[model samples]
Target: MALITRLSTQSESFNSALRTLLAFDASQDESIERATADILKNVQQHGDSAVLDYTQRFDRVSAPSVAALEIERREWLAALDQLPSGQRQALETAAERVRVYHDHQRAQTWTYTEADGTVLGQKVTPLDRVGLYVPGGKAAYPSSVLMNAVPAKVAGVPEVIMVTPTPDGVRNPMVLAAAAIGGVDRVWGIGGAQAVGALAYGTQTLSPVDKIVGPGNAYVAAAKRRVFGTVGIDMIAGPSEILIICDGATPADWIAMDLFSQAEHDEMAQAILLCPSASYLDEVEAAIARLLPTMPRADIIRASLAGRGALILVQDLDEACEIANNIAPEHLEISTENPQQWADKIRHAGAIFLGRYSSESLGDYCAGPNHVLPTSRTARFSSPLGVYDFQKRSSLIHVSQAGAQTLGRVAATLAYGEGLQAHAASAEYRLNLSN
Candidate 1:
């Protein structure tokens, strides 16, 4: 039996089949929603007490107060110090590369004087504080800590508060080390919807954050959705996805493992391969089968492949690029002789990896690009999380006396035409003063 569905563009039912494959039921689970609502409401009203209750109940870690859950700066430094030399070096290297990449994304305030001496520009400013929720316990993601916190720091955020669940009260040292390296100001041993609520609505111990960024379980996602108006959020991400456009030139095993990289994330992740050669697709399938037994997460990879993965056959690379534009996958790998030529044709993808050597895993860990990409075709209109997400722009306008006289007349005319008498009067008053 085949591990993944194989589709041919020549089939009459191809469109319908493709739609079915792409469709993901993103609808919130009713039970989860109700629970999340209750948690958020409780946390908002009761503050630290509510967070403490939920933390104890969910994480099974009793704390005297929310303050007790806070990890000190010394602890973070100690964690970094305790790490094996190799692991510490790797973390530092990844952090430095990420910092360098985000440094290039920083936006500076700019202003230009017009002919009439009117100054107009935009002032770029970072948010005061940001909340980073990292998955903890068995699912420790130190890379996520660097990805989220480092960008916020690069944007010049004054403080970054990190929250992670410590199931059975065992903290992951790597996560703490990452917090230290990424310049996270505070760390709290809290998780789920309660942590999100605490970040959104200030608790007695934990002050509210300007924005919340990071990944977590369903409850955390739900909490972020509910509190969007009160505080900004990075994105309500869907399952991970990877789309590889191969020209049958890359090695089959390399392509197979690349697909597995995303599939191992969870059962809902989608991995699709598009190539002109049918025989190459078969070879990749053979490789997947041969390699499946070796992976520790074989069951998860198998389920993910069986559920949402595909081996697509296109007429040529052009058709494949067209289909890729429509899909707008989170991670797009163009593996061919001249990969950049095909990449130039692509307009909608979270991140484009060129050539056979560029693997998605490298981007996930340390390729100097953000791994927090738009998923489930959201890449068509959205972008990957970056330093931009942590910063905002304010329009600057300083009109000179000469400029006001000239601009106010236009403003008054438009305001009057729109039946806004007060607006017209205000502009006309400015014109009169300028005169």
Candidate 2:
């Protein structure tokens, strides 16, 4: 009945065992990669016809033309109008909070004049268009529609095109409602690698987007990888991750369910708990055994917990903080009395949930901050998606006549040192007083 792993930092084998527990093989399947490559090529060469054909083959939804796949702006609004009162209110509230949070992230253009009258700064502008890919099949995540599209719209992206797969050609009203509330310019009921390809390569019916954002299955991830250079893409998200550092003060069932929140994501998802109290770890284990049977996705949660989840006894709260930084988890919960102290000590995490009341589930839903965060320890280098993702910056330089004389000589010196005679001559020509 040992459903999950138990470890101790004091054990002689702890380091090796920790490595084994933390290891995740994120390599894409060769078959998926090849399939994605073929799809991308076909979409590139054949345009709308290729997309229509693939939609029939992959998603099993047959449309006469790719244009028929598009869900018009009025339909998006109708979807919004059809929503139940509570669901509609929730979507509107979440959208407003997300928009308000991103408004602070907008970068402004600035230029400063030098003593020689040289002007230097940078200009920031929003992307013209963006593509959002929402997963549709078993579930409809209206939250995802808000999370992806709201930030892009807040960044002032003019057009947002959305793609979601509908098996049996059944559309989810909430997703469309979210797209409407999020201000998406267009919506296309299509998904898988073909949807990604259509967005990346631009078919006759769907215009190519500057960047593609949102989540999908393995095939979609591979297609995004193949088409990265042609267009920008959000992070290739891995399985869900949650690491909680508990001080043993919170109720055990609360912590147990928190672990289960991420574990239900799938087998590859990881959920780990670090605590200084052995008794608390025991209490959590008991809670997991008692509560897990009641979960609807009990099999998935059990598989995820047994495969990658762990509960480790650390030396102290300080030691738990150190290990948390090393893990660089996607979702970190500092469940303690003085959570801020431990939070301040932490250096890497996609998002940090502080105190006993702050749950990772809240961040996934109505949180003002972004929920689309870096995964698989990518938080160490990459950041969560934000308004900055949809904005590009260009450096501005206006050199005065006197400023050019000074800058031209410096440029000539560097060009001469690098042995570029043409570059040196070009700089020298600017320095010359031509008649």
Candidate 3:
């Protein structure tokens, strides 16, 4: 018996089976929602006192004040300096690559004058401050720190405040090192709904941030969803996903490991392979069986594979690409000869890795592109986190005397048609005025 489900596009039931496999209930847990709301309200009302109380209860670390929870710059620098040479070099190199990649995504202000002498353009400006939420404790992700913070710095964000839970009051040094390398301005020993609240509503000690970005558990996701209007938030990411379109030319063992990479993230993560060869699918399944026992996270891989993973035999490479477009996976790997040809056909994907050697893990770590990507089919409409996420644009309009005379009549006519008398009068007032 195979650990992952096998499907054939020729089968009549394939469409229904695929739908069942793709179904993920994203509804918020009512109990968790209520709990998160209470935390946000308490934090908003009592300020730092409420944040401290929740931090003590949830994280088991009591602090004299929220200000005391601040992790100083010296500690971050020390963490970076004290890391083993290899680890320090890796962090520095990854940060530099991420920074360089995001630099190209920075938006600039531009203006153009009309023939009538009216100037219209856009003003691009970075957010004043941003808050980054990092999952901590046993699940430290220094990669996430670089992915979130480096882009903001590249966008010219003045301050990037990071909040991570120091469970049992022990901080992850790698996370601290990444923060130092990524240009974070402040760090706080905090997490959960309270952390989101502190960033959104601002306590006495912590200033509010313009936007919050990063991944967290259920309560944190709910808090971000609830406080969206109060402060901007990145998308509520779902479990990680990877869809591999294989030509069966790549080694079977390599494909198996690629599937395992996303499966190890969690039991809910999805991994799927689409290929035109039935024999190739069989070989990959055999590889999975042989490799499963050797992995440290074999149990998680097993569960995720059994629950959502699939080996789909498509009609051909063209059909495989079509199916992949529908899936809109977080990561898409085209493992074939001339992978770029298939990549050119792909309409939606958070990230695309071309060729056999271009592994998804490389992109996740140091491939010079943002690893913070859209998940759960959001790739169809959204984009990867980049410098653009941290900067905003303001429309610039400077009307010359003659231009306003021509524009005001059009504006007044539209306002009058909408039955807005005051609006029409306002536009009309500017009309026929001396320069």
Strongest candidate by lDDT: 3
Which candidate wins on TM-score?
1
Model 1 TM-score is: 0.99
lDDT to native, each model? 0.95, 0.92, 0.95
Q: On residues 1-435, what C-alpha lDDT tens digit does candidate 1 reach at each position?
A: 569999999999999999999999999999999999999999989999999998889899999988999988899999999999999999999999999999999999999999999999999999998999999999999999999999999999999999999989999999999999999999999999999999999988889999999999998999999999899999999999999999998999999999999999999999999999999999999999999999999999999999999999999999999999999999999999899999999999999999999999999998888999999899989999999999999999999988889898899999999999899888777775623
On a 0 to 100 scale, what is the lDDT of residue 122 in model 1? 100
Q: Can you rank all candidates by TM-score, best first?
A: 1, 3, 2
User: How big is the RMSD of model 2?
Assistant: 1.4
> Per-residue lDDT of 1-435 in model 2, one digit per residue for the tens?
469999999999999998999899987788988888999899999999998888898778899999898888887789889888998999999999999998999899999999999999999999998999999878678899999999899899999999999877888888989998998888898998899999998988888999999988889899888889889998999989999999999999999999999999899899999999999999999999999999999999999999899999999999999999899999999999989999999999999999999999999988788999998889999998999999999999998888888999999999999999899898778775562
Query: lDDT value for candidate 3?
Result: 0.95
- Which runs of model 3 end up more than 4 angstroms from their true locations? 433-435
Cα lDDT of model 3 by residue, 368-425, tens digit: 9999889989999999999999999999999997798899999999999999999999
Clashing pairs counted in every model? 0, 0, 0
Least well predicted 10-residue stretch by lDDT in candidate 2: 426-435
TM-score each candidate: 0.99, 0.98, 0.98
